[model samples]
Target: MRLSFFLLFLTCSVFALNIDISNSTIANGKTALLEFKKEKNISYEKIVVDKKTYKIFDNPINSEMSYVLLPISYYEKPSKKKVELFYKEAKKQKTKTLFFKIEDAKYKKEKIKVDGSKVTLSKEDSKRASKEYAEAMQIYKTTNEKSYISQSFILPLNTKITSEFGKARVYNDSLKGYHSGTDFRAKVGTPLIACNDGLVVLATDRFYSGGSVIVDHGQGVYSCYYHMSKLDVQKGTIVKRGELLGLSGDSGRVTGPHLHFSFRVGGEQVDPLQLMKLINKNLLNK
Candidate 1:
């Protein structure tokens, strides 16, 4: 009885540690979760592990919650050992908790373990995958669209990010590569807003994106809002900033209700927070 009790206590203590990026043993490019526990907020530079170093991103504006998806090269392989994280804070600031999760082959192929399962995408929908990348590029270049100069991009939905961007995933038993967007957790009818004002070029239900909405915010900046409950705007419709475009829900390949938001500058998928840091929040406040 004493041994069992001790084991239970140890388990609880480990969980209470609240460390992110703990499950790195499963696969590469897994989300590294770390908590910044400190007496006060402090700005430090870089996280160092196994003599390998990583730099902290620089930005002017920031949100309460943020995440980044790194390539597989960011982590060490084999034993799936724990790597140490270092911090670079601009000023001494208090850090409460940081948590992490990694997406592996097993995680991607599994269906929703929770009850009340709803299908978001079907096999037949594959016919409409984005075959017109060239057309999207053409519209992105030829138009006098408004460029996104804001430092902080708004959350496409009102809820928290359920699934992070760039997580490795498997869809329909096929191993998909790195995730391209951030998933916002919300109910079936939560309002989905436009992060910035731009032209609605592509608005269609996709097999994977599901009830997807793509907006070109000029200067080759494009934001894709996916897994919507409903789409209120149409293609070619000019939308204003913060316009009500749709509602958040599980419309695509997902386990629960969330909005998958992705930002593309040209063809590469850069960090959404980078754009957020560039845009001024004062304009939105007005």
Candidate 2:
């Protein structure tokens, strides 16, 4: 794990604020943990990064602390970025700016051969896929302020990883797009589990994803499981860590049976493994 810690102290009229960042430099398609602590009462306003505003949520384990997860998309430009933190103390508004470096991940390329129909959807199929995508995006746009899990995130499958995230994918000699999720090798009917405690926001088969499940872990963090053979959970069901989710198989636009796991933090698709490591090491372990 490549980890860097930074601490900054800001003196206010009636309180002192301490800010800690887990990583000083982050790669594209990765996440960083930002923590804030205060000696007295403080109201966190928001966090602005790369001209986008992210919500701040209270730390579940520590009442005096607040934190937010910063996600860098796979296509985000590699350069130095500024993060602005806004807060209120003693009826006065205060702000702080922090800088972090974003570097290219340099993901590998992959070529796959699946059914031609899956790549070129028909009119009906295209409409259905578009509707499904819009529904999923709606769920991701809303952030639950309260976190559901008090422990570190776990892997959905304990098997070998078949494909990594952020890989440029080509289907049938035509460049499609990048792989937005991590793929794990799983046989048909292989039972899968939830990575952490959360509410199942979406559980249904779609035109492109097939049998799919998405969980909201609160505070703008969501985990997605796609291309499942069967879904055991339903929408609005609350699940615990390591609970049964469904069975994995070759579904949707795929060449074989596997589990596709990914994450969205603050509406940005990120590397699931990297987000898990950051959450466990910087938030849960602290």
Candidate 3:
């Protein structure tokens, strides 16, 4: 008699991953930009962009990179649009780059432009804004949250976007600027809500943000509400979802009453519209 033994082996296929771009084409006076970075050993060329978001029909003639799609804009000058790209591979890389190819409605390389009036900051003001931007980027580079899986992020304030994001802003009659956040047009003293279940990172008043609230929504995803009439939450306070955080008002550099709401996803400034879409798709529809 003889005894025999056999072993069975199985292998699982490993697939490469990337963040694809969606709806990248634009009109002549418009531009499309996608931010991406090189990952170790990962072919950037294998990355396929979201046609709806990226508008790319074929593969790039050159380069292999992993990229993240960003907000697009229409401008008048050839100024570089900037964004932060965070990558991790047993290590980390925090880099900023101008990534995109702009095309007209005719599909030609349109020259991207910028309106210099958007920033009317003095030397001192520029320094301060630069410092704040750096701190926010550091937070994104260190936070570990992986992706936008949360169903609905609570609104910083229960209100409508009166001014809209990225609109050409005119501060006072003399100073001109671009609106960095979506302005929720609300009545004075309207109750504001916390955008997420996170610890209060900053709660204070300043010359520009006026009475502002910044909450660290874990993973470097921070939400800020500004131009507040009142502040109910204090720094270091743990706020629950939909918690009463403040009241709306024309507190900061504004012409009328409104709640200026802003969001930072992994340190990149993204359109709040995406958040609404996520809520509708995952929360309401689900």
Candidate 4:
């Protein structure tokens, strides 16, 4: 899928900058790719979306083509918003704005009865959970200049999807939580693969997630694998896309054995399916 920034905003007023959007209608919890190329001696300093700044990434397919990626948070409301672009030409600073149509998306509600103890945590478990959450959040917020993932990603196992991202789960019809990851049905000892090339940031069994592995794909993007029966990789271990990481099982508070796979971008949970589709579209050049 070529992201043509050609003659964008034909129905709207054109900005003074050379910019084109990857899509006109962007759904919530999705990503947006911007194709941008600087004029001779004129380049952008930063790209702003919803008051947050983003760095420009070089298009791996075409060196001359630069792009900006936006990972819209699931909490973002549907509306028309403006993206600000700041650039400098011949030492002169300038800025331009582009509008995007964002739509709302709904997730499937799920209700499952699990152990009452799982829903209610003790004082010790609460403290441990808090610390673990903070650690994971820090990893998600970490920024790296170089993109560690260069190629396409592969599924951990070839199995049917049993659960989806953003799925809302109500435990015992009381405790509610959102399913921030995608789940694939896999039996015990099913070999799991790393989605892309990255260093293992965390590989340990926790209270809720059980055996989990979080890979830092650099550039504020991370992939997570949870509820594994066995983990082969360690912290700081570099893994390829198809490299074995572990096996999937019902080690956590799950009803059955499955691989709960997910991705985090810019500290927000996004749809793994949409993320993979956008990534595959970009990797078509390979």
Candidate 5:
């Protein structure tokens, strides 16, 4: 990945600003880390990228800095995108603009065979799935404005990866969609842990995901663990890193038992491994 840093100073301003982006050219379905720093007294309002406004969170490692995670959707077209920073300087709002490039990701195609009923859901199952999707979307759209994570994120399980993120999925000769998450090899009763500190916003069994748990790390960052056989945490539970959240199994629409781990940053589903690396380097470990 390509990294870029920009330092700017407004004329006669009280402080100088430093902006850092994890990559100047990011691949689709990946994530980019954006950092802003100035004097301790200086504060930022929000960030604008690709016509979307995202909230800036206080850097967990450095109190003088703020950061946001930018996720490029897999469906986003390859092009040059702009980032606009909005801040206040001496009672006057100022803006700074930076540009980045998005390239196509070379994701491999995958074909898998599963139960026919899983691929073609019945009418009742389809209705249940739609309701579950809407509920999950509501949780992802709500930003808590406060961060629960103070340290770097960890993987939910330490196992071989069966399927990687962003793979084009062809289920039973029909193109369903791309894999939005990474699948880890697990047995019927393998333990699953929370990736980081978060509040359990949703914990329930659903039509497609089976037993699912969605954690809110706050500031528009969420982690999801899907297809579990058992849920150890409940909604409204505050979990720490490495805490037991559930047990993996073949509970959902899958060919085998595994853990599907994903991330949503700024309301866009991104590659989990990519997001974890960037966040640790640019925010928690900075």
Candidate 6:
């Protein structure tokens, strides 16, 4: 009888821990931060939202709790999505689900009448693009156990945005797809800066992306720079916030000289500016 009573008390205490979204409702292309409290030492197993794995990490400076920055896709529809959190419970594990609501966001559509040859890929270019995409996707899909990224992310370019994220993009005469990254109108030699403190994971010129760079800033987060005039960093190089990366230029399928910046969380591409805003509030470096 005493053992049974003690177990009941333990169960009640463990279930008292709190885990909830900071915002109940958020616009598409933004983010939702999951804050955990009352549980000082816990291990997060996995977090799945809308069938996609979200990134989960412990606060580097604070050991009392952890956070998961749920990346809201820029094109996600206005609907309720289910989020399942698997976490440590006692000597075993437990699960919890939350219904997250997403709102629609109006996006601008733009058409570029670029050279037809630029839009249509040759057989050689197609093969190369396939390989490059495969490699990039691998980096996005894998999550590091430790957070490599520092505090809030900085903008790669501070100039006016020529194209916005989630914008419906039409190239030449056919639909290309939604613009996954924000574009900045830049000169051929306009310098680009690193978004945060991260390790250069991939730095090479691709068939479609041109002089490209991918930075792994830990915590299942990554930032990409595309269509650069030059490559200044190499693979495995650790960079600091606001460090010079390369120069912007017109490359690949673009119509003019510009810089493309994108952010990825747990293999999903999200709005870079939106990510910066979300990080500024939840995960700034101390």
Query: TM-scores across all candidates?
Result: 0.51, 0.94, 0.55, 0.90, 0.94, 0.89
Kindly list the per-residue Cα lDDT of model 4 for residues 1-286, writing each as its tens digit.
3344543454353544566565767877788777676578768677788778887766655666676677888777889978887777677886666677888777778898888777888899889888989989998888666677677777878889988887778889974767888899999899999988888999999878889999987767789999999999999899988999998878867887889999987777888888877766753243
Q: Candidate 4: where is the Cα deviation over 4 Å?
A: 1-3, 6-16, 283-286
- The all-Cα superposition gives candidate 2 an RMSD in Å to the true structure of 2.3
Worst 10 residues of 2 by lDDT: 4-13
Clash pairs for candidate 6: 147-219, 148-217, 148-218, 149-217, 151-285
Candidate 1: regions farther than 4 A off: 1-125, 130-152, 171-174, 279-286
lDDT per residue (tens digit) for residues 1-286 in model 2: 3343333443334444566778878999999888877446578778898678998888877777778888988888889998888888766888877788999899999999989999999999899989998998889889898899799999998999999999999999998989999999999999999999999999999877778999999989999998899999999999999999999978888898999999999888999998998888878775
Stretches of model 6 off by over 4 angstroms after superposition: 1-14, 38-42
| Minimal lDDT window, size 10, model 6 | 1-10
Angstrom error at residue 31, model 1:
19
The order by descending TM-score is: 5, 2, 4, 6, 3, 1
lDDT of each: 0.52, 0.87, 0.52, 0.79, 0.87, 0.78
As for model 1, its CA RMSD to the true structure in angstroms is 13.1
Residue 227, model 2: lDDT of 88
Clashing pairs in 4: none
Name the runs in model 5 displaced over 4 angstroms: 1-16
lDDT, model 2, position 31? 92
Question: Tens digit of lDDT per residue, candidate 3, span 185-272?
Answer: 7888999997657878778775467688887765345678888889999988988778899888877556677888887654455556
Q: What tens digits encode model 5's per-residue C-alpha lDDT throughout 1-286? A: 5444444443454455777777889999998888777655457778898678888888866877888778888998889988788888766788877777989998999999989998998999889889999999888889898889889999999999999999999999999999999999999889999999999999999878889999999889999999999999999999999999999988888888999999998889999998898888667875
The number of clashing residue pairs in model 3 is 13
Clashes of each: 29, 0, 13, 0, 0, 5
Question: Model 3, which residues run further than 4 Å from truth?
Answer: 1-151, 172-175, 279-286
Look at candidate 5 and tell me the lDDT of residue 271: 96
Cα lDDT for residue 275, model 2? 91
Give the Cα error of residue 20 in candidate 6, in Å.
4.6
Candidate 1 per-residue C-alpha lDDT over 122-223 given as tens digits, one digit per residue, 9 for 90 to 100: 434333454544555565445333444343356676666666654555554454455666777778889888887788888877655678888887644678
How far out, in Å, is residue 192 in model 5?
0.6
